[model samples]
Target chain A: MNESPVIELSGVCTRFGSQTIHCDLDLQVAAGQIVGLLGGSGSGKTTLLREMLGLLRPSAGRVRLFGVDLDDPDLLIQRTVRRRLGMLFQHGALFSALSVFDNIAFPLRELRCLDEDWIRRLVHLKLAMVELETAHGKLMPAELSGGMVKRVALARALALEPELLLLDEPTAGLDPDRSQNFVELVGSLQQALGLTVLMVTHDLNTLAGLATHVAVLAEQRIIAFGPKDQVMTVDHPFVTGFFGADRRKLL
Target chain B: MNAIPCLRVEPGRVVLTGSWTLATMLPHLADLQNRLAVPLPAGEHWDLSGLTRLDSAAAVLLWRTWGNAWPEALEIGELHRQVLGRAADLPREMPAAVKHAFHPLESVGRLLLKAAHNLRGVIALFGQVLLDLAYLFRHPADFPRKEFAANVYKAGAQALPVSALVGFLIGVTISYLSALQLKSFGADLFIVNILGIAIIRELGPVLVAVLVAGRSGSAMTAQIGVMRVTEEIDALSTMGISRSIRVVLPKILGLTAAMPLLVLWISAVALLGGMLAAMLQLDLSLNYFIENLPRAVPVANLFIGLGKGLCFGLVIAVVACHFGLRVKPNTESLSANTTSAVVTAITMVILVDAVFAIFTRQIGVPQL
Candidate 1:
């Protein structure tokens, strides 16, 4: 199968000051697959995600999205490719100044072609997809609980229907029940929309329950990468340590 | 995408047409939902077969309005049917809305209470700074010298050019106007007295205070506010660092030391500007204006101005730090605290200037 990779990272390296976070890391994510990027704290999972989104540049190697290098000389082409990608920041990064409806409507409004009515309907539809009531749309980000903020941010991420969805610790700070609900919701949405997802997470449950493929980052490299079951069996010390601790649950 | 969608209602039928897509203006969906919620005629039907274009967003809206299911009597094509059916399955649970009641008297009471609480916080911060200062004096080696020096450079050295420029301009404007009026009555020499007393005793200190309040004061609030927002202050506390000594005290000390020097610098530039304007407008010589200035305004006025500047700096720094520490963990609060800090600092400077005027009213007047 020669299907082109939607996300490609070859021999990537990321450094901050004297610290090297990632070294010679290679990864490829095809279309319509949920790839769980598992790593411990300070494992550079978030930094790698940032690198993929062009928010950070790798000291070495290249990041390609939709087969286009993000550092492509042509700005328009880079932006066009970026439009096909969506990111959910670690803290949801919802504009506290905006109501939930306005936050979701932001991307639609940026398109500048849709009328207010269409934007409202689309916003309501996205909200519904995330299981948020119509009334929740009127609340500001500060007024929302942690889980509801995540849901609202999820709706905003889906508003543009981006083909590639990048999530940074989506379940962090969420209670287990809410985290499971969020996972199920994301899984269903991914299937329905046929989205390619690269989720940075340390949650074993999320990986075991939802990831079609898994990439374990440790010691500045991917220690294991493959289908979840196969990666779980990798003989590396870090891999075994992580999987061993959660073997009963993962299996 | 091109054609706007419209919903037409007859007695027992709803006709949908045009491009019912994301780009279309579908303003009446809420109204349509409300209308449909009412008991309609028994044979009422939704006729979507007239639609030329349809998208998932349009279908979802229709699906939700129908209570997450297909209508009993409807007409639609295969593509439209699939979109609506899929949207009908999406989750749609939301908590009930919260209603907040407004009370005019209670609102006013709350505002007054908030102001009092803020004043209490400012006084408490001032007391805390004094304690920190006492502790620092006892243990001089533990002082945050680097932080204090950086703050001094930021609030003092970097600010000199702009302060000098504004001071010069203000002095020129004031002196030029006063010269015109003094010249009309052929009392042109009195321009030196007016310019000297105003520039040295009153204008210089107040002008520098206002400038620093807006520039360095707001910067102080925003910097500390951001630190709080990012939890850096909390991290410092966790690391056993005293925020008052490391952060707030340094800013206060830096500003206090800088303000008097700034006032002196600004006064010099302003008097130069006044001398220039006097020589040009009143045909008075620069030498004559310079020689007459000391006798006209006296050296005591300069000391008064410097004292005022020192007091203004202390108030502004304390107020800025107070508001900065009060910032909530949000961008909105950060911006609000920064603005409040600047406004409150300027107001405190003006109030203190008034108090100084009343107290030192006779101290610096030329005993003519």
Candidate 2:
């Protein structure tokens, strides 16, 4: 408990012209916990993730990562803070101009310290971890299939060995089998690297397989934040309605 | 925070400790590389058990430092071993880049083939539009009237202010410069003839053509290129709708209909600018200048300018749509195609203007 949380958001509020998304929302994600953020459609799950990434500033309150305010003006502090985290966007926002290899090598090359040999080895290792062939590295982003795009994006996210991994809809478009494989891949990687993952997903299967903690966003705040079983047992309408029939399988 | 990675050369072993992760190793990368470079003594071993965390980047560094093999006597945790195992399993060599040998004649032949292919594409697109036009004539209900009107507004009405500004500036410059020469020869009255013939017959159509090509031509290409990239064009095809009818024909017809009107508008504004400059520079009265314009420049020149504008509009639209439809589903292709569209449209405008000049050489010149 003495260790600071990886991500902390207190009294966060988001408003877009009278429509409020998050109000008085508070969350503290400890290190090495895979927290799945669940919400209904139009509930602003992605917006909350974007806020945590510092892409969208909350209308009020503070967002801190590793005990440092995300709004700090120091360039070096911002860069250092950003370097410790990686985000996988929903659509695998790969650089369309670069080949798969270059896209994955981008963060490593930005470090400006690693030689080509080390980068090559690390990139190939990441590719292997994501169950992709080295031959696939030469293909452009436009040529990749939906599942391959997610894998390549995951590889790129892991390129920097970030302690905090933020995944937005990690298994949205993949087939059931591919999604299961993706869940396993991420779960094992998280275990191996001790990553603190905050993923936004609506898929119950993905949430069941990966999440150590569940944070349900509803009515502009997190209604339940705890272990999956504990959150499922909460006496709330959203909790009861969300896990109605398949509650037994989740535990 | 975990301790920074530290390496010590003890009496009999190299002891490594602390968090050996990419974030921690980045600042001390050079120093670590220097320390790791020293050869271990014959009896020495590596002790990695004291490390708190070992990430992939640090694993790769250690794997390389040990000459791509485990040390003869090493101590490491099971999880760290697995981390290193991933790095150890990577294939040694990268896939080689494909290279093509250069050949002078082959390069020339390729360029010619590419040009011929592009010419064929343009001709095919033009023929498709003609077919679409005929279909629309047969069934008026199927015509894309809304799309056509939108195109006209976008390519023509939206372009008025900038075109007028440029046209006026060019007119004032040419008139002021020519008046100086005419004044030297005691022929100040000749300014009307020079300005009328030049702006009405040539400069008005060519200048507007260049501006529209750089403006609306690039826009059309980029719009259609994005449609192609996002598969919207294919969606149209799946719905039993012809893209040529809906997209291409409207742009070509709309721009063609708008171009002549724009030419007339810009030419009039330019003439007004020239008249003002002439009056100030040479004391030529506006009344005499307006009356003398008709007599100085033949009516045939006005027809020639409108004809040029019509042809330039058609050529620009066709070139833009041709390049647009050819865009591949990628960012690089979209940008390259848009650039090619504007450049080719402007070039085609000049080339068509030359053809107009040659064929109408005998028609437009006043009897001096």
Candidate 3:
């Protein structure tokens, strides 16, 4: 209310035909805050992210990112916004055809006007951050282990030095140790790089350990949104139920 | 019920109207005109007073019913202009070919252009395969060690047995035929000529190339097609890796490099097989057959056979890649494309062989 929030949502509704996936939802993220998008699968966390990204238009209500209405998404604004966002998709979704270097170079190739040498240099820098061997840059994705694939894809997402990092289940399909390592890598990078992070994850350790803020989506709306410690309280039944979701509840 | 808008026909200067939504009543117009052949009414002016709404169905129906005689067609001016307007000037006198520019005929033209583009893409793909072959040495490192081993195993080693069997049968038949013919001249020694000339010069390379085309060509298609379906190709593209460079070029290079080697080996083996048959049929000594075989044929014939084998290798690679690219994103399409690749490669091989046959004769092929 004092100034425009980093992300502002009001009465946002998304529907597919008669099935109303999310309706009349509202949430906000203040400037420079990392937020956890917490929900079980099919609970509209991804859809909400997509809506914020303007990939899907809300059937109703206003979504203002920093100040831009997501409904009438300005292409120029979207491009600027996208340049600031780094998305780590499920299974890392690393372009299987690319080498580790090119995989890391993708966003730079797409979003930046950097030449090959600079792109290569940036790729190696990112590879070092993820602690992946630069020699693996020459190998195809099929040659990599699951953990390395995730690291390379993460490196690609960071290629453009994005301000906002969106991770969709970053720790899924990893061993507990690898998952913890990935989360640590993300938190340390968030601090060092001064980035805003919005992550969709079912990992309890991520919420407890990595998040600065948390937003729990239930009944097609954020039931609670605040700093991680405040939001983690067992006040709402849905929030409690989700918090109690076991480690085995995830993929 | 009071007449609601049934069909509001408006196209150019012709108008016809009825009281019903067009979708339900549109089919009735066809039935009304069909079988009975009763001329539905038309005039210089049409009545749209009975109509309430207008759409595409009514517009087309009116045009088809009165297209021949109507000096010009009726066009829907606006919803409020419910009656047929003045007779618009239209070039009805234009030739049928000229009018064909306006309608369904344009769709036919589109079809032909599509076919042409598809054919152009195919020809372009063939060139791509050739270019890939020419540039093979530049990036030979792109081929994975496993891929090379597989290509050698799949294309060369695996294919030899079939070629050997075919070559064996062919050798036995040639020996039998030679013995039957050369007995008349009491020059059963010509069986050495038959075994040497036939196996080394023509049959060996052609038979081996055909065998590889069926086996290796089909395998390439299936592999690429599966990759296409599985999004492995997309994985490559999104990875900023060129499928042409990484996936396709390697196989083409492997085949081009290995094929001539295989052909030469199989031909020698096939000749040996013929030597065995020569012993059985003509009771000819191995040394006699082996020694005379080289003199009876020249290097020119070997060159011809090897050249054809190279061309066939290129053709198989291109054909397989073509069908692979043609594969729809489905397993069924993968299977279909694999079959088509083999069939098309073989067909093209035969057709090219005929062309070569005609060409060599016209050019006065150097007789070995």
Candidate 4:
């Protein structure tokens, strides 16, 4: 593993209207590690993800991505840092007005460096990467089925060839078969592109299939963080209850 | 790790190095494009093994630069070759956008069909509300009384201040302008007849109709449209509730019930404004204006005004509900339906008012 961390959260705190979600939370994700963030409902899993994306600022401490502070004042540096990571929202928040092709091409077009031909080719490559047909590009987001919506959203997130991928419930709505296919797709893509992934998921199948490292969050902090099997062996209530009888099957 | 992407031309070879990713290439894109455009020797060797990372964007650029073919002599890693292979495998032709040839006659026919279809939908919705009313009459327990009251509060009670403000301004403007004309002709008393008849019979209903159409009508469409988009309407139907009884009828009936009251309120306030302006400009006494108003404008005109208010209210509500129910499940459809609801309600109110004008002209007019 690389020594330098791709994401570092040190002593982070999040409070909402007299309710504290996270206090003094610290996590360091090294390069190319698929960290499955496990937590019970309302345990601030999505909140932590949003904090990392800079969509929400922690009340205290620092959030650093690629070794640069998210609070860095320089606009150009912030933009550069943002372009290095992509996030997939829980509901596949695709733009309703744009076609699937335009949605995927949106980030590339923002660069203003790639020409139309290159964008067209890159968009096709991304669609293929997500196992979608080229014809799917012509459909609107509203027209897509639930599975297709997830795929299209994934394609759009991967548009800029982001080094870090953040997925919030990537397979929440998919059936077991489709979710398995999605897991395999993501696993192969992660290996090919050497992407560091941070995913929040409740599905054990997804966790077992893809995550190289596991981080269990409880009591407003990460209770355990290490290689999957090592983290599973940690004597924490959340870890035991979460894995339950399926611990050996995961191995 | 953060070396700038460079393409160096050496003897008998082209060497590409560094992290050739989008972020690294963005600033030097123009320079790279310029250098890549220059012709190289036919049999030159290309070296890309030194590159630490290569994103698909860089792969596409390289694929395009090499004349859509591999270099004669090239040294590249297996992973880089796979990235390049994906780009090269992209289909040459893009999917074509759908096109239609313009035909004026067919276009006109389609528009007429659409209008007829909309008219049928409005009539059907009106019939459904009537049916729902009949059903509620037998089972008064099932009536959406709270929804009706809420709609009235939102559309009717909340609209009072704005209506009064607009009504007062129009009354002042018309009364002041007429005072100027009446003073020159020594017909100052005639100002009472003009203001009373114009405001009570025509302006009150039409003004309130337009305001209500823009305010309450658009809101009704948007509320129902969003419900449709989020499947709330479907959820309601799945529970065995008639949407027309619970959703559509309350809005139409509430607006219908509130509109006549709104017209009466606005007309009374507007007369007060006209009275104030008359006092300032014509030195007309309030007692004289009030006492003689019954004789000058006649009581039938007040009845005509209230009747027009009732009809205008029904038409506006029906038109608004009609367009609201027509909304499809998309943002574009929601916005389009809301706009069409407001516009169609106002237009229908004006059209109904014109018909009322022609029919009631003889009843409301005083004999000279």
Candidate 2 chain A lDDT trough over 10 residues, lowest sum: A185-194
Off by over 4 Å in 2: B98-110
Candidate 3 Cα outliers beyond 4 Å, as residue runs: A1-3, A71-74, A245-251, B1-368
- Judged by DockQ cut-offs, the docking class of candidate 1 is incorrect
Best-first order by DockQ: 2, 4, 1, 3
**Candidate 3 per-residue lDDT over residues B1-368, each given as its tens digit:** 11333333344222334432233232364553352244434444455545543322233233334552443323333442321111112222321111233578878899789657656766988687667656665877654566656776778777777777777777777777778778788988777666666666567767877888888898898888889878899999998877786777667767876777777877777777777876887788898877776667666667777777787787778778778888876455677778878887888888877776777653323254
Off by over 4 Å in 1: A1-4, A9-27, A38-44, A57-64, A67-83, A99-102, A108-140, A143-151, A216-226, A229-251, B1-59, B64-69, B73-153, B168-191, B235-250, B273-291
What's the C-alpha lDDT at position A188 in model 2? 76
TM-score (all chains, Cα) for each model: 0.74, 0.97, 0.44, 0.94
Candidate scoring better on DockQ of 2 and 4? 2
For model 2, what is the alpha-carbon lDDT of residue B336?
Answer: 92
Q: Which candidate is the best by DockQ?
A: 2
Report clash pairs, candidate 2: none
Docking class of 2: medium
Question: Which ranking of candidates, highest lDDT first?
Answer: 2, 4, 1, 3
Q: Write the per-residue lDDT of candidate 3 for residues A127-206, one digit (tens) a residue.
A: 76677755777776767887887888788777665656788877777788878877777776665445678889887877
Worst 10 residues of 2 chain B by lDDT: B90-99
Residue A201 displacement in candidate 1 (angstroms):
2.3
Q: For residues B21-131, what per-residue lDDT tens digits would candidate 2 score against the true structure?
A: 999898899999999988877656889999988999999999998888877898999888889988889876776546699999999999899889999999999999988
For every model in order, the TM-score on chain A comes to 0.95, 0.97, 0.89, 0.97
